[model samples]
Target: MGADVIERYVTDLGSRLQGSRRQVRDLLTETRDSLTDATEAHLDDGLTEAEAQERAVEEFGPVREIAHEYQAELAVAYGTRTLVWLAIVLPLMHMAWEYGRMLLIGPWQDFGTMPPAWYLFIAQANDLTSGIASGVALVALILGRILARKYDTRLLAKVGAGVAVVAVGTVLLGNISIILATAHLDAARLVQSAPMLVATLISWIVIIRFGLLARRCLSCATIVA
Candidate 1:
């Protein structure tokens, strides 16, 4: 009888959450343990089994209320994961692409038809953008840990999601600008090297993957009511 009530409550609570599978499972397990403990306490006080479970569920608060609280924590966890990915992957992707170019095609100076000053400036700026975005992600991640207990979970989640989106967007913006500038100046340069083209494609795929992550992070943060 008590198991039925606990099952119903846990299922309802689980339905409202969206996040890392391990995180969600851990929270649900903890909820079950708490409810079981509460029910046992009620039973020790002489309440019937059914009465104990009902009381435990009541004490756990309304399903919606509890779910909202859990959702906030889950959102924060999701944001943290996304930030970590951004911090580590962004710089590595940038470096890998740069190194692949240097190895496969030598320096840009090796090309007979050198690109103009504006193209070089754009390339340099794009490199700097990736570094800056990675730095921002690292700072946000560190501050998130430091302020975990100091700030509201929802606020932290929103801020983290926003940072992730902006960081990804900055990297993507730099890539697009450089691509367009290169295409306009010398379209042949874009596809001259098969190896570089593959590297560029991989870079674009990484950017798109993180863009989706940022979108989902924002979605998770937004639904924390």
Candidate 2:
């Protein structure tokens, strides 16, 4: 292929991959410049421009294959950074919100009057469950980040599975605690505490959302692989 033909093929390949026009242009420009440099080097060895271009194209392999490799690398980098940000910010945000709720409205009023031993036990259990869930989630997020760096889709899927499991377990524990509190104390009072109820519901919703997002991420990994 001639230089113009090779350049057009690379440009067309870039257009086919989803992204902003600027991004696609930048990627194609980089690829084209690199190939041009290689072709120039080959030309210095006494090959004609057309022959050099052809050899460069052959060395670069198929345009689609090159584009896919570029896209996957970019995706893994973006996804890893995103996961790391979420890992750092999310747990801290959740803890802050939980503490804020406790301070603002006091403990779950419905369960406060329960036997001292029962409250102590339940509180311990709550802490234990929360700690375990958070620890597991943090580890999963970290592993996912590492796997993403390696572009190991299978490992990413495993990380997603771990996250989904922890999320489900946390949701289950939260719901059970709410039920027990409502059963032992005044249902009316619990309902009246709109902030507490809303917070709980939001927490559950977030868990469900994470589960769904993880599944989608896993599916993307599978499709890409």
Candidate 3:
């Protein structure tokens, strides 16, 4: 009977929250651990098993209130994870693509020197895309940590998600602009070889992965009911 109460409470709490699977599992595990410890302490104090469990549940607080707190934590965790990916993975992917290009194709011909000014502008923007995105993500993360307690978790989560989306969007647009410009100038450079094609595919995949994570952050934040 006591076990049933705990199981029921955990199930209900789990049902109320949504986010990364690993995060939800971890929080639920902690909930079980704390409740178990409380029950054991009550038992040591000489209460019957059922009575001890009942006492434990009471002290643990109502499930609805606990679920609200857990959901907030889940939202924050999801947002932080998205920010870290933006900070680290985006820049790395950009670097990898640049290095791959250099290895796969030698420096451009006179095109490198005499590309049209608009093309040059787009190329420079593409070069800075990842760095700018990563910098914004890092700043947002630091600010989030500083203001975490003062602001609501859901708001922080939504803000983090928005930043992530904008960052990724910037990178994506930069890449597209560079590619389109390159295609217009010399389509051959766009697909130098099979290896370059594969590298480009991988870069796109990484960007899509980050975009999905950012989307999930918003989903987790908005599900406040």
Candidate 4:
């Protein structure tokens, strides 16, 4: 019965929180360990099993409240991770779609020949931009992991946010360049790429959210320091 109660509480907490799955699992495992230890201590003190279990649960406080506290911390880490992923993926997908579309329908100067010099230049530029964005995203991912693990260090958080901003900015600029360079910005293209556009909007939102949270964490760290 005590084990069942602990399982249910951890399950409920897991449903309510947002973060890395591994981290959440680790937290639950730690909670279980602490509760078990407390229960064992109570039992050693001559308490009944039921009484010990109840005391253990009470000592840990309410699951919902503790989960809320964890949510506050993990939400920022989740946002940081989400932004890093979108920064890396969205641009690459957009560039791939653009290039694929061009290969299928673009005008070629000769039969079975390569695209024009301008086309090659633009493609190279897009690839280079995407590469730089991906590099920034990698940096952001590494720094975000450090921030999440340490849950402190204002400098690391700031650097992570800065890298995320650069990555998102690069993606934005790449998208704009693709739009300007292509002749497919008509209603048909808009309808076809609507999902991608919506994803871009969501990416922007994630970037803004992560950036704000990172700044808030930095501010708090400064105050604590």
Candidate 5:
């Protein structure tokens, strides 16, 4: 029974190793094909299959190590892309929907019939804060992309720190603005503004998630390097 168990464990490990090897091989092949095509176009020089294979393998470093690195990098890229899209599209849609509701149903329907000046001030503050946060998140996503490409650990850490700070600051500012606006308005109006609060919370979560992803990617890079 012990021998059988040992055999089964070894078999499972062998299968996993085979799957990993195949994945790494596919990635290496794609990388090599792209590079070879570009090199041929730029230099009008073609490499033999053996030469190209050797060069690609050399550039990719150790196969096992690079496979692990690629896994982390791909995860970070996927997460960052999701966060970027959410940051860019969600806030704008929220603001537009809020404004549309106010326009159609009147400010009282939404904001409890506040003075026009107060309405405008609140709207402006909301838009400004949302825009700033989205912009910062977008910038951080871009920086994360750049750092991922370069595998720059230090820069990734810096970008993550900046994102965390901006996300926290935006949340604080948004909460304060909402409180101040609602103080002069009815409690019911504050409750009506829950959508904005929810959106802000979602944005905060996305920012924090992506920031953590960046930091984790950087940490993995440090280990690999």
Candidate 6:
């Protein structure tokens, strides 16, 4: 009877959590072991098995409460990791796409008539914007990871989410600026930019997904354990 209660409690708790099943299980393992130990103690005190199990479960508190605590922590941890990976990856991919586009349409590559010097200047400005965006993303990533690891507060996590949102917005702004700059150049240049445009779109989607996850983390209460 005691074992059944424990199993049901854990199953219910797991059902309430938001992470992967394995992650939820791992998070609750220590809690389950502690509850079991408490139950054993109650049994040693001469309580019946069912009574001991009931007491142990009561001491552990409601399943929803425990699950919410664990879920909040998991959400913050996962948010930090996701943002860090995006910060590292998206910048590199953006740079690579830019390089590829430049190589495909460099002035010297195919120029029946060399475009205006202003066109090259605009291209350089676009590169500068990309560089600025990459730097901001790195800053956001570093700050977010530090905050997530150092503090277990919803406020800090919310701040991290804000940083991530800013980073995403900055990158999108840079991409749009580049696209606009491309319009001042030859139509062939825009065609050459298609691959980079596609890459930017994909990166935007990834960043937005993570940003939404970060918001979810922000909504959860801080875990205390």
TM-score of each: 0.88, 0.54, 0.83, 0.49, 0.45, 0.67
Among all candidates shown, the one with the greatest TM-score:
1
Q: Which regions of candidate 1 fall more than 4 Å away from where they truly are?
A: 1-3, 44-46
Candidate 3: where is the Cα deviation over 4 Å?
Answer: 41-55, 110-114, 149-156
Winner on lDDT between 5 and 6 is 6
**What are the per-residue Cα lDDT tens digits for candidate 5 across 1-225?**
422332332233233222124543565556555545543443344765445444444454554554555554443443454446546764665576567556544555343444567656776776676567677777777777687568663344345444645554664566567667766654555445566556546655654654554454444334333
Q: Is candidate 2 or candidate 4 better by TM-score?
A: 2
Model 3 Cα lDDT, one tens digit per residue, 77-120: 88888888899988888888778777777555534667778888
Cα distance off (Å), candidate 2, residue 212: 7.4
Per-residue error for 69 in candidate 2, Å, reads 3.8
Q: What's the number of clashes in each of the models? A: 0, 0, 0, 0, 0, 0
59-170 in candidate 2: lDDT tens per residue? Answer: 9878778767665544443344334534554466467656856766667544466445665576566655545555666677777767756866445544654465555556
Candidate 1 CA-lDDT value:
0.89
Candidate 6 local lDDT, 107-190, one digit each (tens): 444677765777667556655654564566567656756775676444344554565566556655665665676575645555
In candidate 2, the residue pairs with backbone N, CA or C atoms under 3 Å apart (3 or more residues apart, or in different chains) clash, namely none
Q: Which parts of model 4 are misplaced by more than 4 Å?
A: 1-4, 72-125, 138-225
> Which portions of model 2 show Cα errors greater than 4 Å?
1-30, 39-54, 71-79, 110-133, 141-216
lDDT at position 60, candidate 5: 42
Best by lDDT: 1
Candidate 6 local distance difference test against the native: 0.64
Candidate 6 — which pairs collide? none
lDDT of each: 0.89, 0.62, 0.84, 0.61, 0.52, 0.64
Give residue 205's lDDT in candidate 2 (0 to 100).
74
List where candidate 5 sits over 4 angstroms from the true fold: 1-75, 107-123, 143-161, 168-172, 191-225
- Give, for candidate 2, the lowest lDDT window spanning 10 residues: 74-83
Poorest 10 consecutive residues by lDDT, candidate 4: 216-225
* Per-residue lDDT of candidate 4, residues 22-61 (tens digit): 8778888888888788889999999888778888888888
What TM-score does prediction 3 earn? 0.83
